[model samples]
Target: MLTKRIIPCLDIKDGRVVKGVKFLGLKDAGDPVEVARVYDKEEADELVFLDITASFENRKTLVELVEKIAKNIFMPFTVGGGVGDIGDIRNILNAGAEKVSVNTQAVKLPQLISEASKRFGSQCIVVAIDAKLVTSHQSPVTSNGQGTDKWEVYINGGRTPTGLDAVEWARKAAKLGAGEILLTSMDYDGTKDGFDIGLTKAITEAVGIPVIASGGAGKPEHFFDVFSKTSADAGLAASIFHYQEYSVRQVKECLREKGIPVRL
Candidate 1:
């Protein structure tokens, strides 16, 4: 079995690390390069750096910052936000990112997923789906008599709703040659309540690619719950790690005690 991964996320804005609840009311966390180094030292399985406002600002990812962080961290690095095309993906990879995550651009032009995957291999392409739960009235009815609480994909850093079903999108992204899915729950992001287990499992089952569950991680037990209840390959958190509420080593230790395999 593949050891479960614990990833620390850096939500960057204006070239600095920031954390916000449900994608609003942003607060500065720390410098990106410095934060990356700490996680690297803590033995985090991987690091994700997202330029949260890049797509909204209509600019590319900060490759210079990526290079700076990559130089300090030996683990795999993934960068996202403001990635527009194959050239942009190449730029980020060349800057030392092991993978490039595309969200708004992929939703706008899904062919970009195929193109990037073909050009750089699927292992280098990740499709990020930011999803929010839909109300009963907005959701479709199912056989169980309860309205299916569908997750709708949001883009532009969760500023726009695309009316796309999250599970369907995950399936499509996998079919399009994406190697992994970075699924974030806008409803749970930064809340520290725990990951959206239903949402994570739904997408994990809908796609063959590895799914990294993001949002709503409060404690070490939350990580255990996600890995135990869902087929997700990884759990990603920002505020908990950024604010030093819990160390990566602590979480890994907890998972090990619970019989979950992890790289300690």
Candidate 2:
């Protein structure tokens, strides 16, 4: 079996690492470079840097900051947020990111996914999907307790719904040559209760490419749960690692003890 990956995410806003619940009420986590260095030392399989507000603000990713973080980390780095065109993707990759993740722009101009993947091998392209449950009830749907629940694609930092079904979009992105999918459950984001297993399972089953499960990871066991229950190739969390609730090393150890293959 391939070793599972443990990734720590850095959600950047105004050049500072931030974390929030359900993509609302953001809080400062720390300096990007410093946080990247720490995750590097902790042996995170990969690092994802997302400029959380870039798309909404209509600005490009902070290349200078990406360069700074890239220099401090030894692991594979993926950068996303406000990536508009091929030039932006080229600039981000040139800044030392191993891959560039496109979400909002890719939804609006799906050709971007095909074009970027062709120009810079599929391995260098990651298609991010921010999805939330489309429940009939009025209250928020944090966890996909029901396997039948449907998900809709949201863009612009989870601010706009594209009316796209999450699973269908993943399939389309994969067909378009996207090498991987970074699927985030906006409903469970920052809840720290656990991952949206239903959502993860849906996307993973829909696409052959690797899927990184994001949102709702509260503790080490949450990582093990997501890995064991779903076909997720990687488990990503921000608040837990950012707030020092648990180290990447600890999470890996937990996985190993649970018989989950990981690069310790």
Candidate 3:
């Protein structure tokens, strides 16, 4: 079995790490490079750096910051936000990112997913889907008949609703050559309640690619719950790690004790 990964997400805005509840009221956490260095030492399975406002502000991801973080950490690094085309993907990869995550651009021009995957290899392409739950009456049923409720994809830092079903989009992304799905539940993001297990499982079953469950992780038990209750390959959290609420090693230890395979 594949060991479940614990990833720390750095939501970057103006080149500094920030965290917000449900994608609003942002607060500075620390310098991106510094936080990344700490997680690197803590043996985090991977690191995700997202330029939260890059798409909204219409700018490329801070390549310099990515290079700085990459140089400081030895683990796999994934960078997202403001990746508009294949050129942008190449720039980020050359800057030392192991993977490039595309959201708004992929939704706007889905061909970008196929183009980037073909150019950079599907292993380097990740499709990030930020989704918010919608009532059954408001949205269509998921193509994968795993559930009754529905989720709509949100883009531009979760500010715009794209009216796309989350599970369907995951399936499409996989078919388009995306190697992985970074699914973040906007409703649970930063709430620390727990992951949206139902949504995670639905997408996991809908697509063959690995799914990294993001948002709503408060305690170590929350990570355990995600891996136990859903088929997600990874659990991602920001505030808990950024605020020193728990360490990566601590979470891994907890998971291992619970009989969950994790790198420790």
Candidate 4:
């Protein structure tokens, strides 16, 4: 059986780790390097650093942060946000990112994926989609509706809503050459209730690429619930692991007891 992966997400803004609710009211978490090193020591399966604020020339800043963390972390690391083009991907990979995640930029120009796959191989490209829930009433009354009930694609720290269908985007991204999909539920983010299995399962079935279920994971049992109920390839979380509220080893132990395969 393939070992289940547990990934820790670091949402960086202005060089600090921050967590917010439903992608709002952000709070400072800690230093990126510090948190990353801790996760590395704890033997996290993978580390993801995202600069939620993706506008402006964020590439330089992100590369520097990646360098800092890479110096101390031995595990696979992924860096995302504000990646403009193939050049940016090379820059990030050169800076030590094992993988580069693209969101807004990919949405803007999907050919970047094909061009990118040619340049760096398909496995290096990951498409990260930020999604919220949309209800029946919120639909075609226009598939794009108003308020929190809508599943809008948020970029730039939840400030930009692309009004694209999350499910459709996931399929399109895979067809465009994305090796994996990092799907995060904006609704359950930071709430730690557990992952949004409905939304996650939808994407998993919609796309052939590996689906990493993120958002609302508050406990190890949550991982079991997500994987058992749905085919999400991995579970990614933040607050629970960052605040020392949970550790990678502890989560893995709990998962093992539940008969979920994990990397100890």
User: What's the TM for model 1?
Assistant: 0.89
Go through the candidates in order and give each one's C-alpha lDDT.
Answer: 0.84, 0.85, 0.85, 0.80
lDDT of 1 by residue, 112-216 (tens): 999999999999999999998876564322212123568899998899999999889999999999999999988778678888877887888788889999989
User: Candidate 2: which pairs clash?
Assistant: none
lDDT of 4 by residue, 99-135 (tens): 9999888888989988897789879899989987665
lDDT computed for candidate 1 = 0.84
Candidate 1 C-alpha error for residue 27, in Å: 18
**Every model's TM-score:** 0.89, 0.89, 0.89, 0.86
TM-score-better candidate, 2 vs 4: 2
Put down candidate 2 lDDT per residue, 71-124, tens digits, no spaces.
777779898888899988998898889999999889999999999999999999
Candidate 3, superposed: residue stretches over 4 Å from native: 20-29, 55-61, 137-146
**Which residue pairs collide in model 1, if any?**
194-216
- Steric overlap count per candidate: 1, 0, 0, 0
